[model samples]
Target: MTSMTMLEAINATLRDEMARDDRVLLLGQDVAQLGGVFRATEGLLERFGPDRVVDMPLAEAVIVGAAIGLAAAGLVPVAEMQFLGFSHQAFHQIGAQLARMRYRSQGRFPMPVVLRAPFGGGVRTPELHSEALEAQFVQSPGLQVVMPATAADAKGLLQTAIRQPDPVLFCEPLRGYRLVRDEVPDGDAPVPFGTARVAREGDDVTIIAWSAAVHVARRAADRLAEENISAAVLDLRTLVPLDEAGILDAVAATGRAVVVHEAPFTGGFGAEVVATISDGAFYSLEAPVARVCPPDTPYPAGKIEDYYLPSVERVVAAARATVKAP
Candidate 1:
């Protein structure tokens, strides 16, 4: 195992995947010369050459549309969107063409493309650079949505996504890129989708989160432990092929749940988790599922983002509320 940050793990994974599979190529704005905005693709161009790591125009639609063509022609293109908030510009290409290619082609065409973007808040990025719009992508059929919170999962999940048959939207947490660190396995081992990892084991309440919120939930669990409140933190690594069984099992054991996410309270991915628990483990629940999310407002400035994003205190409060809900 090697101690590395999320970005380092991602860079290593991309390097490994490209080297292992000649068909794997990368493309996006400033990816080649600039090495990506976050340097996630740093040193890739020098290693893979310009043909394998092509830099495209400043257009998300063009980037995704071209990737669709590349994937159809036999190349596994890993396209970067710079930021999740800016992805709306290419929604038509992603949702209409890339996502529907496999289903629309009736088993003829397979789009094994990876659309990656930096997401979430805490770094105080400008508008369209820090939005947690994961719920939007999760709704896209045939599009696998992956958000890795830790360094190890970042590399493992990305490798798995690249090797998969369908298109994947890999949401790399901006704050976690350098802040989060873990002992990643020496060799490439794919972390499967639809499997949730239990970050912390407890029987009092289940805390569900993904991306950067996982760390916040972990901190909340640590604080709750001091109060003798045992909280089990569940990280739903992939949102599309969600680990329903794992989510249900954790909530069933605890009899209560508190979902924390950085997105708005309304129409957030947390609601889907809560709904699933409500349908699958309704009888086992001791209290109503609680969600700790930001208000239905735009991503705030970095100065006051603390008030808009989920924090340890907010999660603890939500957990306390869930326990109190008779």
Candidate 2:
């Protein structure tokens, strides 16, 4: 096991997958020579050469459109959008073309492409740099979405998504890229989608989250423990193929749930989770599932962004509400 940052782990996975499969190729802006703005693609250009690790022009639409053509021609292309907010430029290509290729062609062609984007706020990036747009992809059909909270899951899920025979929207929390470190096992370790990990077990309330919110839930769970409130933390690793069984099970055990995320509360991924629990575990639930999410507004400037983002106190308050509610 080696301790590595989430970015390093992702880079290692890309390198290993490229080495294992000749068809796997990476393309994006500043991916080759510049090693990406976050250095996630560092050392890849030298290791795999320019052909496999490519640096394309500064057009997300063209990059995604070209990736669609590449995938249609029988190559597993892992395309990167510099930031999640920029993916809007390729929505038509991704949502209309790449995602619908298999169904449109009746399985004659499969777009085995993984669209990777560094997402979420916390680093206080400029206007559009720190957006959490998972709900955009989640609402769209024909695309699988996965977000990893730890370095291990980041590496494992990226490898699995690269190998899957469909289009995958892999959202990596930018805040977790360098903030969290974990010892990842060597060799090919692919964590299957639709699985959730229990970060912490508790009986008071279940805290459901993904990506960076998983860390928030964990911290809140720890804080709750001090108050004699046991909060379970469930990391919804993959959002689209959400672990419905795990989520329902946790809520059944705890009898209460608090869904949390950095995304805005309105129409965010948390709504889907709350709906799912309401549908599947309504009878088992002791209290209405509450969501602890960002306010429904544009990410504030750095000065007040901290207030906009959900904090441990917010999560703890939600947990208390869930427990004390009639």
Deviation in Å, model 2, residue 314 alpha carbon: 0.3
Q: Give a tens-digit lDDT track for model 1, residues 272-310.
A: 999999899999999999999999999998899999999
Cα deviation of 246 in candidate 2 (Å)? 1.0
List the pairs of residues colliding in candidate 2: none
Worst 10 residues of 1 by lDDT: 124-133
TM-score of 1: 0.99
Alpha-carbon shift of residue 134 in model 1 (angstroms): 0.6
lDDT string, candidate 2, 1-326, tens digits = 89999989998899899999999999999999999999988898898898999999999999989998999899999999999899999889888888888899999888899999998988878898888889988876789999999999998899899988988999999989999899998998899999999999999899999999999999999999999999999999999888999999999999999999888989999999999999999999899899999899998788888898889999999999889999
Using lDDT as the measure, which candidate wins? Answer: 1
Q: Which residue ranges in model 2 land beyond 4 Å of their true spot?
A: none
